[model samples]
Target: MTRTALVVRGGWDGHQPIEATDLFLPFLRDSGFEVTIEDSPEVYRDAERLAATDLILQSVTMSEISAEALTGLRAAVAAGTGLAGWHGGIADSYRNSSDYLQLVGGQFATHPSTHPDARHGEASDNFLDYTVEITDLGRTHEITRDIADFTLHTEQYWVLHDDLIDVLATTTHPVQPYHPWHRPIVSPAVWTRLWGEGRIFVATPGHSPEVLQDDNVRTIVERGLLWAARSE
Candidate 1:
């Protein structure tokens, strides 16, 4: 039987939600999924439809979510529908919904200032070169198995998370001259969690389509989608 995969996109254009999601479409089809695409979160309200889905790949970033939509999504996840996404699409969405925040396990905080002279409220020139170190746990995990640690030059996310989830990969940030920090900080670059019987997969590298196109990032994301759907 063919599995159903839903791709919900569209939000801040800066994240390139549509383009980022498009990069993975061919792969999802090639993997034998019957894909559905939606441009907004309203689809989450169709609980019956959501219940029938095998996976949800969302890319909504920094958007307001309605209580109804949020409830439908959280319910679907608890009912065993898989959830997966990368970067801001999944983790950085719903800025004020605590329920959504709890389900995602993290929120986008701030990255090191990329601009040498960035001022408050202005975009930071904070794209840093970083290495993602795959953990021993990830070496054998379905989503990250067989992939070696990789390096990326993009907006490395700094997020707030809990200890309930399993971290698959991590990155360490050395104190930058621009930020007021005296010590290095370690953050999860990839992680997975379980909500009821559902599987949740998240990767923090997809700040753009180019980041997702990186061989390592794409491979893991592809596998992550399948893994979340219980297809692997």
Candidate 2:
């Protein structure tokens, strides 16, 4: 059976939802999935449309989705449809909606910089080479099947997440003079969880278009989508 995907892209323009999603759409199509792109969250309200979809790729951030739309989406996932997203587009999206947060399983907090002034000045310059460490690798999961440890220059996410997430990769944040926290923190970079029979995959990279286009980042995301959409 040919799989179908709903690609919803619209929210904070800073995240470049439109441009970043454009990169992934062709990838999905080339992978043999029938793809549909929607700019509005209205599609979430259509139960029939959502129920027919095999996967949902959301790039929305910091926007409020209607309760009806939220309800329909939760129902679809619970009934075994897959959902996947990245960074603020998914993890930091719809802050007011606890229901959305509960489903996605994490919230983006802060990316403490090497220079405190990086946030106001040129934060992109502080985008250092960082490695995403494979944490729990014993499970024979398709997402991390042949994937090895990789490095990227992007905004590493410090997320507040649930224990239910099967953390596939993590990055350690060492306490530096700039950050006086004095604690070694491990942040989850990639993770997967099952919500009912449905699969959900989230990667906390892709802070910019360049990051999304990175070879390693692209490969991880591609595998993530496939893993999320995989059926028993």
Candidate 3:
């Protein structure tokens, strides 16, 4: 069967939604999907289109979606359309809509600066070396199995999430003398969620095109997209 995949991408040019999502176009096609691309979340309002979609790959970071559109999106997913995304594109999007946040399972809070002296607005402030430790569940989950702990120098998202999500991997923010945090803070680096009959996948590491190119990150994301699609 030819599964339909929809790519909704735009917002916050910093994340390079176009380029980042472009990286996976070939993979989606190779995976037997008939891919469609949209630059805004407005497409979510199309119930007929969404009903035919098997998966949704969203890359709009910090963007807004109308209440009606959000309703459509939630309904489609609940009816078995899969939703998957990486980094700020998914976690940081639609901040105004708590409904959207609830559907996604998490939200991006902050990426602490690498040093206290670093200026807040500088791009380099949030870039730091961090390790993603796979959870026991991750070792066995089809989306993350065979992946070992990996390190990266990029924006390490401190996400605000709930227990509803199944955490697959985690990254810890160590307490530094220069920072105010009293103890190490751990956050989910990769996770999945079940909503109705749908599957949702999220990864917090793809800050740039380079990060998406990492073998481990690339492999997990590719497999995740496939795993999230509506099952036969």
Candidate 4:
């Protein structure tokens, strides 16, 4: 059977929701999913339309979702549909809804100023190289299959997570000159969770367009979407 996917994207323009989603379309097509792109969050409330979808790719961030819409989404996932997203698109989305947070499993706490010492520049200017370490390899899941340890020059996420996630990869930020308020912190960059009969996958990287274009990052995300959609 041909799988169907709904790409719901909208919210803060800073993350380039539509643009980032464009990069993943061909991947979804190549995987044999008939992709439908929606620019608004209203689609979440259309229960009839959502029921026909096999997977939902949401790129919305920091937006308020109506309780009715949020309810429909949770129902779809619980009935075995898949939900996947990256960075703030998934983790930082629908901040007002605890139901949404419980489903996604984590939240973006902060990206401590990268350049705390730059007297004349923005703290973001201090952003530097960071690597995500792979942990809990025993699962040997397809999402991380053959994926070797890799590093990326991106804003490593310091997420606040609950124990429901099956963490796949992590990254560490040693106390640096730019960020002295905290000690060494290890953060989960990739993780998956079982939500009722559905599956959910989230990756904390993809802060920049270039990072999302990386071959490794792209592959893992592609496989993750499929893995999350499968009914086990």
Highest TM-score model number: 3
Q: How much RMSD separates candidate 1 from the native structure?
A: 2.0
For candidate 4, lDDT tens digit of each residue in 1-232? 7788999998888678988988999988888889999987778888888878888998898988988889999998888889998888888898988899998888988865555445356535635578877785613878987787788866678898999998898888788765555689888889999998899999988765677888878887888899887452
The candidate scoring highest on lDDT is 3
Task: Tell me the tens digit of each residue's lDDT in model 2 across 1-232.
Answer: 7789999989899789999988988888988899999997778999998888989999998888999989988888988889998888888888999998899888888876767655556757557667887765613566766667888777878898999888988887777887868898898898988999899999889887889888767877898998888473
Candidate 2 worst ten-residue window by lDDT = 136-145
The C-alpha lDDT values of all candidates are: 0.88, 0.84, 0.95, 0.83
Ten contiguous residues minimizing lDDT sum, candidate 4 = 117-126
Q: Candidate 3 regions off by >4 Å?
A: 118-121
Off by over 4 Å in 2: 117-120, 123-126, 230-232
Candidate rank order under lDDT: 3, 1, 2, 4
CA shift of 94, model 1, Å? 0.5
- TM-score for all models, in order of appearance: 0.94, 0.93, 0.98, 0.93
In candidate 4, list every pair of residues with a backbone clash. none
Candidate 1 weakest lDDT stretch, 10 residues? 115-124
Q: Name the runs in model 1 displaced over 4 angstroms.
A: 115-124, 230-232
- Model 2 residue 168 lDDT score: 87
lDDT, residue 65, model 2: 90
RMSD (Å) of each candidate, 1 decimal? 2.0, 1.9, 1.0, 2.0
